[model samples]
Target: MATKFALLLLALSPLVFANTASADTTNVLFLAGGRSHASGEHEFNAGCRLLAKALNEQSGLDIQATVINGWPEDQSVFKDVDAVVIYSDGTKVIQHGWERADQLAKSGVGLMFMHYAVHPSAEQGERYFRPWIGGAMETGWSVNPHWVADLKALPDHPISNGVTDLVRAYDEFYYNMRFQEDRDQVLDLVTAVPTRERLKRVINLWNQHGVNGIGKRQTLMWGIQREDGGRGVGFTGGHYHRNWAIDDYRKLVLNAIVWVAGADVPQDGVPSETVTEDALNENLDTYPKENPRIPLPNVEEFMQLPPATNVSMEDYENAKAAQKNRARKAKAKQLAK
Candidate 1:
């Protein structure tokens, strides 16, 4: 009877250990910047919330995601997180905490930056950003142009798991990044050729460098695995907040978040429910009265728009003047109030 009882206890030990291991959860932290761009453009806080909501409610994975506006007041928040995602203007959030962030990187925590967050001062770019994320948008070298990026192909990567079909969107996609010297260590996840026909406006940081690379392929999204067993990703296509309504665009980011967290991406990638116009409007930052609310695009209609072509310099100037006029009038109206 004693021998039989001992055998039963031994059999249940495996089940007990399995349950314990399965209960462990992965923690991801988001550092969102304050209001930066015009309404319906940056939306960093809202964007982070939307993404965190997806991971918490829709991802079907054991992920705990937290979003802190600007930088966290409590530095302890960084402790124990498996990954960190920054969606903000430039590198302001991590400006004062480079050492802390570097410690995280050295300890094998995953890091990712999106949109303008990928841009850092050249000094910081060389000192930290390039090594941390494999690349950074260098001023005088990189160009931010609003164009139709017809992402027709993706490399074979876990981040590309469920991302199928063409992901063409009009965004301020920055290219010509300054990457690490060891090009062999970087994985270009998404690349698209920027053609003269695909460009809509080439105003910011546009120069001889941008003009020379019009017909060449550029890396819009890239990833790297560091010697410390950490992972990093740089994405340059989150300029328009409304673009989040696109399924593939949202999924690719979701997949990256999971992959960076060291979690197993589902065979079909991290599943997320369709984003509605109502959902898109939630959690947006309050802007000045002059900045009118940009309407959320109807997913299907927006996707069906024809490929973009270069806007004539005259047309660009006219549009810029009209926008300024609207802002000036709106300012007067607010002052009257």
Candidate 2:
């Protein structure tokens, strides 16, 4: 399998492209977060731009990925894109630009969720996602821990086209998702068995409302073909943006995007250019230079989280520091008075 990723760029095409005689073009709208745990953790904006550049540069592919840095100021961007790929902090899948989900679903648009995006709260499961992505990460019912996932073998599917064995990655892989009743509509594309070392991290792994997946198989990627003729996919590995460099990892995702967009996926998956170190750092989020890395927050303390997820390390530290600064200033003013 080749190790190149497709980049998507904004094109002046109409609401939809006529793939019949025009190009085999599929316009994919990418959504990345404006903030994250660290400068390069989610790297939503940077990663989306990287994908856009790769797809735009594909030799024979005509797919374009227009990336929205954050939630669009105007929702008109969802006019008629083939697919919507979101890679950000997604605790609420129904929010964001999801207000247009009805329209998109009515038009048979494809939806792709990556990394943290796959983990929506339990309440969101039956409300919106079960019919869309087929499954979602439920709090207390799921686990997120760093593990060296060996994507050695892939299932026979368009999403796994041209993907070879022996793809290894160290990422925060969240597993044990809650799928719909007739789970046959969806299938896992990528599967990995946890190593002994990583298995220890998940002292309590839950799946299907049971304590499962510590010493067994896990689904890292899944695709859903909704009865409405639309498509939905969920990828559990995106915590580390750098993992996108792995050829098989990148190829698998590229193939899925095309497949979801209702485009013909090549036998060798969507070909992408070799991403360089310089390219990885291109459009990263801004972070405090003085504080290189922030400490990881203690989840036990926030047993009752405002959301179903933990705070990004960087954002948590920033908020903590801001509170301290405010208190210090207040004390100083009192002394002067």
Candidate 3:
């Protein structure tokens, strides 16, 4: 009877554990920044909502996703979250709540920063950002340029589960991040060679450092499993909100969110429905009437568009001046009306 009972318990253990695991739901919190940039650009709030919708309805996992505009005044919102994702302009969103964020990190809560959120002040980068997210965009060292990144390959990681095809997109992909001293802990999930020919526009902090980095293989997205048992991810390619329409681009980010939340990424990754044109335009921040709506890129045509020739500093400055003049004229015309 004792021998029979032992075998029966073994057979039931797998089922029991599976049930327990499935019952535990992962909660993901997205702290989206306030309105900034032009129309269809830095749609932080909109982007967060779209991603949250996918996690809740399409991920096929027991996950609850919430999006809070800016930092929550109520501190309790961070209490039960399995992971916190920040998509904003720099670390300004969490500037006042560093203590609380650190506490969460210590307690093994995952953290992720998208686009400009990864470019914190040097002091903050060394103190909090690097340790928490494995890497950050250091000013003078890193460069943000609008370029076509051919993410031709991905590492065999949970974050790369369903990312099977080439993810080619033109956006402000920041490169040459400052990583922690122990780089062995940081896992490079997505990397692309940023050649001069691929650069469309060299803006913000694009100096000699950026010019010298041409043809270098830069890590566009990365993940790290920290010593504290928490996870961290830094992705520098969320600049163009419209790029979310691309399947592979969207899947890569969705997969990272699930992975960082301490949940098992599905074998086929987090499945999300095809993002339609109407969906892309939804929840956009208010911009001037003169700012034209950005059209959804036809993936094939957009990807096939030839790379721009090398951009020079003089050319960039001239373009900036022209853009300013155009904006001024638009505002003047609006006033006349």
- lDDT by residue (73-177, candidate 3, tens digit) is 998898778999999988779886898899999899999999999999888999998889899999989989888888853667888888787788888999889
Residue-pair clashes per prediction, in order, are 0, 14, 0
Q: TM-scores across all candidates?
A: 0.83, 0.76, 0.84
TM match of model 2 to true structure: 0.76
RMSD of every prediction: 4.9, 11.3, 5.5
Cα lDDT of model 1 by residue, 227-282, tens digit: 98989999998888888888888888898888887888887888888888788888
Off-target runs (Cα >4 Å) in candidate 1 are 1-23, 290-294, 298-337
Instruction: Specify the highest-TM-score model's number.
Output: 3
TM-score of 1: 0.83
**How would the candidate models be sorted by lDDT, starting from the highest?**
3, 1, 2
Quote the lDDT for 19 in model 2. Answer: 50
**Least accurate 10 contiguous residues by lDDT in model 2:** 1-10
Of candidate 1, the 10-residue stretch with the lowest lDDT total is 302-311
Best candidate according to lDDT: 3
